[model samples]
Target chain A: MMIRLHRSPSSSMARLIGQPDLCSVSNWTSRENQLHNRSSRATEQLVALCKWLEMRMTKLIAGTTISLDGFTADAKGSPAALYADFAELQQSEAMQHAYRTTGAVIMGRRSFDMAEDPDSYAEDYEFRTPLIIVTAKPPAKHPKEGNGVSIIFATSGVADAVRQAKQAAGDRDVTCVGGGMLIQSLLRESLVDELQIDIAPVILGSGLRLFENVDQRKLKLTSATSLAGGRTSLVYEPL
Target chain B: MMIRLHRSPSSSMARLIGQPDLCSVSNWTSRENQLHNRSSRATEQLVALCKWLEMRMTKLIAGTTISLDGFTADAKGSPAALYADFAELQQSEAMQHAYRTTGAVIMGRRSFDMAEDPDSYAEDYEFRTPLIIVTAKPPAKHPKEGNGVSIIFATSGVADAVRQAKQAAGDRDVTCVGGGMLIQSLLRESLVDELQIDIAPVILGSGLRLFENVDQRKLKLTSATSLAGGRTSLVYEPL
Candidate 1:
């Protein structure tokens, strides 16, 4: 069935979108006319422009890996020790890319708890950014302050935490770093903007999952990288 | 306002998930109980899993950058030109990851038209996989045949193409390499399984968009990576 899809920019929706003032009525008409022509070639170009404007509203970042069943760590703070070496993860191109764009980070109680260990969190997270811990309880002692880094406490609603983080970001990117608990909260509120995952070679037989329950939502992969140690990193933009 | 959330999984339509045996009522209850217990984590895990499964369903292998105004490409089939060096792009970790997991690829007619340059396609596509072109008209010629590469012609239907692709993939992964028109069809029919995209460095003054006139389906990034030339890669799993 050859459906005649009119690309009239002056159509009611286009008029609303174009706002006669924003796009000029004549400009809208020409744009819509192109759609009316049903040019497979032309339609592709137009759609791309609309999407670019929509994605500019916010920025979000996520990083985590859990059991196949989807747990971030075991009952204790132990995070199932999946990736062979943080050294390899640190050196990968994906890691470098993550560091370049992110200006702030949000962490869950559990992830923050693990991060307190100088051996793991301190040495592991060398990237300089303001870290916000989204938890019910504040850390016994903040690390960033002592180490010439900024560590802020955000123990409230996810939206509130994000607002605080964005304010701290000051036109920079933010990364949501956590296991399942914190990530779920941000996701439910739809605060996350970009997700980066490192696929470790091994899957724990039984442990916590990064995902367990939530209404389904779709996401698209924007980039991918495979490390030498059988680890693959993928980046996603929400669809 | 505490919304009295329903405790039963039946309402969420997850009652049938992971059910070991569908024949008995008692077992069903037990399965539901087990599933419920597993879901008791903080809401964060649920969101991640939702995003994960979401991307698993709809995302195809290829990605395209289109304008926000809703066009797939310009009148001449040029969606937008990527100025990033091809040599550097070829060596990027993200490209390498795509090569590693991808066993087959599919593209729509519009996307195929962009590949009109046989030499660039031949030189850039180093990974050996069966590339299937879905269109009404057959190609005028074949370039890289008999080197573990073959181009099959399909006149209609993405679902059928996927079935044929699975046969070709054998044990490897299959990807739908898209142009906007093909993606629209796939998204409408729900044939896509994964979406991987590399947001290029440049935004065209105007061009086609990745999604146009589609349902409000959601996707979550299972992984993300940043590349060398300000390029970012993301992978989405469909809900």
Candidate 2:
């Protein structure tokens, strides 16, 4: 008997089973059947498998573009210097992959307010998924939403915001963008799984640093690739 | 007629002449002779060539190993975390190149003091070159020196120290080894020609930062190579 599973859900199951290409549960079920020789044992194995899959379903990624000196934004809270090569970097393979895999976004209230036209993000932003704003209080008026973009004001806390975002993301990844405080909080709580930085070839002597007050965490370099216009993309995973 | 120049001296001469591989001065003199066709003019050209070679003979390089988050040392002034991959990175091609090209070293007093046994550097340190110590006052007793390593105390200022170091380096490069203040002063004076960083895969939340208070400068990425043990070697030249 063969059991078909959703590709994303089964991908995590495959990873858990050490067979990354196993897209269906049929092979594992057959093996379990052969080993147990009983229906009850098979049912228990399937339940355990589902629990494992649920645990590894969603990944939280903190991503940003920073200057060579590690500043995410200039003193005036402007990221203009860091985004000089944005047009070119936006077309990079890693960025395209992020766009394709991002199922939801979590941002701080300041980042949401920084957007000139929040409603425009619904149509123009690359990650047209849901947006969860972590704030102490919800805004007086909500922005218009369409094109699969819905805003949720999470007034609870960072952990709760992450929970809501993960639930919304389902089997895809939840990406945290903007506000170093938010990322630092996530890093402190061990909620962030990946950290992605695109280092631009400029030095900002004074600015808002990306890693300020971040909890100490050892990272393993997963990838380092030179991008367009002298930018470098470095991806790290917590070890 | 062929005019042979020392390989290191002529390397810079070739760079100045826009012919990087023209090790011998014959090609350039021959072309000048054809253009001028006068003995007196040839003498003037030779004098001008000597001055140009003098100006471009030595390059000042600032090199260090830093954590992924840009910390050079831990809170207690220990670089243990940053040098975790030092053994592997030291054998990398970029490190070997730096070792081969460096003709002298400049370090701050604190960095020199941090050495448990300063005399041992004469025999063990990779750069086995003359060490220039920039301090407010010279130490009461000098450390023992041998094997082409001599210590010089420069109390005048960073500029005078650089000038003396460049004179000692001759046609080879002068590498600034430690202390952020020394590097920052050199940077403020626009004395640094190259910046080389070996980025280790660790994060130290609190430590000495490398680029703190550095002047704003644009850099051109000369090279970015992944070295042994997940360390990255990034070389940059100020634009």
Candidate 3:
């Protein structure tokens, strides 16, 4: 028999498992509630199945533009040189795919702070999704939230931040925007599902490298495309 | 009136400028020698013109396979991981072009030493051309060279080695087959004309980076191609 899920199975499973309300599943019908109460053993089995499906559906992708030499930013944490081809990179097919698939973003505090005005992201950012900022402490005042964008401060750790972001993402992807340190931590923990690297045609002799201190991993190239303005987009997944 | 050069103008120009016999220009016709003896002033002008043409024609290309994270070799100076896509990389159009156009090679001593047997290069290496090894001192014994391959030890330093390689290359390109240190030195001196990087799908985490300690330079992407076995070939020239 075919089972029709009115809401995302994972969301319903989370509610039945007594997890925090990570997603909105409040519109459950009386029939579904009756079914949930019918068999505890069957519900547990369904929870395991949904959890497996959720793990497969929600991906965490680390996406960033780096220099030819693999640096994400210059010594002073500026990515000015690396973004010369930003306009073209933004128009690339891979980037468009990232934008369409991303439902949440996780970034380090430094990356968030690098923005001249965090409030601008509410309306101007490409991914108008929930933004989870990982930091040791949340700031005193939060940015004004609107346009379906919410700023969340995760002080627990990167792992917790990833969990929250994945929940917010639902079936979509959680993209890790960077300051190098954040991406490195995620890579070290093997939390990243895919790496979308746009290699700019500039060499920064000394800078903040993207892969510094990350665990060694063998990656299989998924796609390589030449973008406009001499930018190459390379997609890889850990093997 | 059109002036045709029977021999390479640079060869004739080098002789006119009283430089070392860098190339074999002995096949100069008597008429050409009479022209070389005819006017010192005209010969001086031709030397300057040929020098400009030579500078424009002969390019120095630094080519190597690097990991996605920019490491040319692992900590032990082994590129085993990087060469996983070598068979396809060698068949790539860019690599084929490199092979077709390269007439001489310059390498560091460490790279030379890495070869189990130096004499095997004559039979096994792709480029059956002159090999110039840059070192502080030449070895007491020389490898048995044949099959149009001659090994020269350049105790005079990298710059002098480059000069010798370029002279030997004649109208073709001089390629630097490296260990990272040699490529870095060439980059520091702004001598590399093109960077032919074959990015393999791997992250070394810690290793010898290809662009380490080099001068910061802006490059324009010439071409980016995806090769067999998930390898990416990117060609760049300094802007």
Candidate 4:
């Protein structure tokens, strides 16, 4: 039996528009992030229509490393250790498969600004596929020429950004790559299908909580694997 | 090398005084929940002195089953299935030994009120040993004469409550039985030496968070064991 997933009108998912092969991926340049010809109202309507037409079973998975005290990032917006122990996960065959199969990445604007430009790293980032950033404003920095990454800014809302990301992901899973308000909204509106939490053995004391103001949700534990260095990854699907 | 154990003066730990062996295991009676001759002030001062003399090394271990969303109990004051999945843990020889060796149990007042009295169960409760409760107000109901468990109320504060609980525990480990405001204070003061968190698959979206207002502390993961009911227990010692 084929499963058909229809757009959950419950979530006003935004319409995702890829920022045209923006700046040539070579020299660092600054371009004012602005919407050129897209009409806001028309885009929202188009996104709704596209969502109605695109009835595919793509899962929007939210993944993040949260502290034992339940913090993903600090108040100042710096993530707790960023990718410190994440490297250990790279050695896991299952983790490697996840990275290879992840079709696209969606993050909040804060994550985009905090993350180093993929071009500067020399090596392509694992999330270099396609990046959709959800923010009211665009970052001052632009991708350099030659970087194998595409950027899309969703000014509309989370629902729009998620819809755009799911459509872009096709049948593969779309990973929500940030914490804070973005994921909070995702939890609030139930736009996410799966949650993969990497529990780090530290308490940031007082930072942003991963789950706040969200209703109780009973999740089914599909998998749990312990990573070296006191970190464990837990995968869950809504029951 | 033999290490010296000492009660922490910094915490102003309380003195544990057991109620007279009341009733020979069969009957109902009503007594005002007041410490007849014990004055709060005298108890505090005596606690300080006893801890100074006792100087015995007793570890206070906090254990609670937390949901994916970090709630240990619901808003209605009921525990997340009060040790429902804990039965699997009973199979572990080490766990059984620990339960047998445990000298006392400490819990917040709410947990005490919410739990079924051991007497009502018509059998010995797993935590049939000495029980210490920390609450601002005394519970209205007292154990019917036949219940074998003993009770001590710590009204002064958490520091005093834990001190009393530790002293009663003797050389054995004292289990801080629930996750609530009392444990939060213990975490704040860095009083807990070891934390054993059982991660339950259920996510209670809006009840009570297990940890709140806690400062950042790095914890060393000592052990991780999976339970049969899809629950995983992670043990950590504060670094």
For every model shown, the clashing-pair count is 85, 0, 0, 13
Q: Per-residue CA lDDT of candidate 4, range A1-239, in tens? A: 12446545322343244223454545533342233333445566676655544435567778888888788876675674534666776777767877776777899877666656634522566655567779898656655523545677788999899878876765466888775678878877778787888888887877778888777776767788777878878888765
Judge candidate 2 against the unseen true structure and give its global Cα lDDT, from 0 to 1. Answer: 0.79
lDDT of 1 by residue, A1-239 (tens): 11212223222332244322233345457678676545544444444443332223336687875422233554454564555557777787677877786767777766667644633444446667777878787757655353424777788777788777766664456788776777767766667776666544342434555543433344555666666554555566544
The digit string of per-residue lDDT tens for model 4 on B73-141 reads 777756645355666767766478668867778988777766566344225556666788887877566
The digit string of per-residue lDDT tens for model 2 on A94-195 reads: 888988888889999998888788787787877889999999988777888889899999988998998889778867889999688898888887888888
Q: All candidates' lDDT scores?
A: 0.56, 0.79, 0.81, 0.70
Per prediction, fnat is 0.04, 0.75, 0.90, 0.72
Model 1 scores what on Cα lDDT? 0.56
Q: Which segments of candidate 1 are over 4 A away from where they belong?
A: A1-58, A67-71, A74-77, A116-124, A140-148, B1-239
> How does model 2 do on interface RMSD, in angstroms?
0.9
By DockQ, the candidates rank as 3, 2, 4, 1
For candidate 1, what is the TM-score?
0.39
Model 4 stretches with alpha carbons more than 4 Å out: A1-57, A81-95, A116-124, A137-142, A145-147, B1-57, B80-98, B116-124, B135-148, B155-160
Question: Candidate 1 vs candidate 2: which has greater DockQ?
Answer: 2
Model with the higher TM-score, candidate 1 or 3: 3
Q: Compared to the true structure, candidate 2 yields what TM-score?
A: 0.81
Number of clashes in model 1? 85
lDDT ranking from best candidate downward: 3, 2, 4, 1
Candidate 3 structure quality by residue, lDDT tens digits, B1-239: 11223335575656667543354558989897676556556656777777656645678889888999998888877889988866766777767877888889999999998879877888788888899999998878898787878899998877888888887887778999887898888888777888889898899998888887876789989988888888888999876
TM-score of model 2's chain A, to 2 decimals? 0.79
